[model samples]
Target: MLVFILNAGSSSLKYQLMNPIIKKVFASGICERIGIDGVLKHEYSEDKELKLDIAMPTHKEAIEAVLSTLTSGEGKVIDSINDIEAIGHRAVHGGEEFSASILVNDRVIETMKKLIPLAPLHNPANILGMEICQELMPGKPNVAVFDTAFHQTMPDYAYMYALPYDQYTKHGIRKYGFHGTSHFFVSNEARQMLDRKHNTRIIVCHLGNGSSVSAVHDGKCIDTSMGLTPVQGLMMGTRSGDVGAGALQYMMHQENMTIEEALDIMNKKSGILGISGKSSDLREVLEGMQNGDERCRLAVDMVAYNIKKYVGSYVAALDGVDALCFTGGIGENAALIREKVCAGLDAMGLVLDPVKNNKRSKVARDIATNGSASRIFVIPTNEEYVIANDTFKVVTESR
Candidate 1:
């Protein structure tokens, strides 16, 4: 089936056209800086890419631009928007309402809106994408694949907080982990590679700008680093992950900042950027570290140390980890970070082969030494594939 997958952010929309059944990509690209001036980067063919400066005043114009390019413009891959069989939206928060992908309907849309409070930065954009797709592609089946769905399997103790029981029952305040799709995809790949598909214990490190660590046991999420929001896990590009509430309160009092202002600071101006006094991108941090920049070095060290601590805790959570798999942008390409994360872990049975770690590859492969008890692998995440597959399934099963 031809699936058009959309991951809409506040200011950007990432899309992919693919056929999951055949494992083929038709076209994929991103519409960046929506609501401001826009840049449309489209990859229609494997080797040919296009970057167009276009006016995308809103997501409506953005979608229209995408549709135009997909059908008739220079980057055309399909004959028309009709050529796409279905649309899949990357819904950021499903809360506890959905445990799996579902065909988009009135109820689904309404529930997604209800989840806006949980994922204020993402849910609205996600809903916009879905509603716009439904408007523009009137007859097509739209599926919602949630980032929180797969993590729904987390046990109560693993997901619940120590907060008042009434708080949870009243407002659903608990750890509904994000990055479920990536963790699900990569951990399954690890399971197959390790040939422990049925009774597997895998730790997935999704180290992107928004990073997360998850413990998957027996193909279900036992626990994940991200809590009710994406801000609770491993340190991220701009998010101050796992920060103390007391620190936030102290800062708010000293600065006389509102909750929103405090959150904006934590979510937008914190993390590696806050630490290094530089860019949020790890590439920059690594470059600075190479130049003996103290804060940048400290930032990198902190990230690695945090990842190592999470891996240690998760290994204990699963009783024993069969494999520790890294995915996402940083996880796949940042060799030095990987090495630092795995350093001094020989006692825990996780050992990285330096040469293998440094070697660059697009495919998933093990980096653990032969003597290591648990396999260590670098598995590139394919979140769109999971979205497309689920979209295909939900649409197929519906018919």
Candidate 2:
């Protein structure tokens, strides 16, 4: 079946048309700058690409433009809208209500609406995309593939905080790890690469602009670094990860800052940017480090240090990891970060082969030395494929 996957953000909509059964993306592109001056860059194939700059005052117009382009003769990806068997949406926060991807219905939509406070920056855009798809493709099955779904396997102890019991039971505040999709995809790929028969313990480090580490024991998520929100884990491109509560309170009192003001600084101005007082992008930070910038070097060291700490903690959590997989933009491409993270980890049997680690490849492969006890792999994640496959399964099973 042809599944159209949509990952709608505050100002952009990324889409991919794929046949999950065949594992092929027939077409993919993105609609950027929505609600401002919109630009649609659609690629039906490598040789067939289309770019249109037009006004998309609302998400409805953006979706309409995408459909129009997909079916248009000049940039036709599908013969008609009917050719799309199902639509899959990337929902950021499902809270505790959704443990897995489900077919979108009135009840699901309502529950998602109730979750707006949990994912203020993401769920609304996702809901808008789903609602528009429902309107345009009335009877077609629309699936909601949540980013939080895969980590729902986390036990109560791992997900729960040490706060008053009433906070969790009443306010539903607890760890709901983000990037569950990416972690899930990469872990499964790691499992395949390891070629293990019995239950395998895996630690997946998803490093990108936002980073997280997950301990997956036998394909189940036991614990993840991200907690309550995406900002609680590793030091990210901008988000301050794992800041002390006392420090925040101190800042508020000292600066006479409101909660919102303090959070704006934590979520936007902190991390590598705050540390280096330079570009948040790792590429630039690496450049600055090469130029003898102490702050940039510190930023890189902090990131590597945090990741190494998580790896050590998760190793204990998993009792001993069988394989370690690195994914996401930084994880897959930044060899220096990987090398730094793996440094001194030889005691844990994760000995990175410098030659293998330095080599870049599109496919998933091990970077561990031949004699290492634990395997280390670089697996590129495919979240869209996971969404498409989940959507296909849900839709097919419903029928």
Candidate 2 per-residue lDDT, tens place, 1-399, comes to 999899999999999999999998878899999989999998877668888997898988988888888887678878899999999999999999999999999999999999999889999999999999999999999999998989999999999999999999998999999998999999998888888746899999999899999999989899999888788989999999998899999999999999989989988999989999998899999999999999999999999999999999999999998999999999999999999999999999999999999998999889999999999999999999999999999998999
User: What's the residue-level lDDT of 39 in candidate 2?
Assistant: 99
Clashing pairs in 1: none
- Looking at model 2, residue 109 earns an lDDT score of 94
Off by more than 4 A, model 2: none
**Residue 107 of model 1: what lDDT?**
95
Q: Which portions of model 1 miss their true places by more than 4 Å?
A: none
lDDT of 1 by residue, 1-399 (tens): 899999999999999999999979989999999988999999988888999999999998999888898998789999888889999999999999999999999999998898899988899999999999999999899999999999999999999999999999999999999999999999899989998768889999999899999999989999999998888988999999999899999999999999999999989999999999988999999999999999999999999999999999999999888899999999999999999999998888898999899999999999998889989999989999999999999999999
Cα-based TM-score, every candidate? 0.99, 0.98
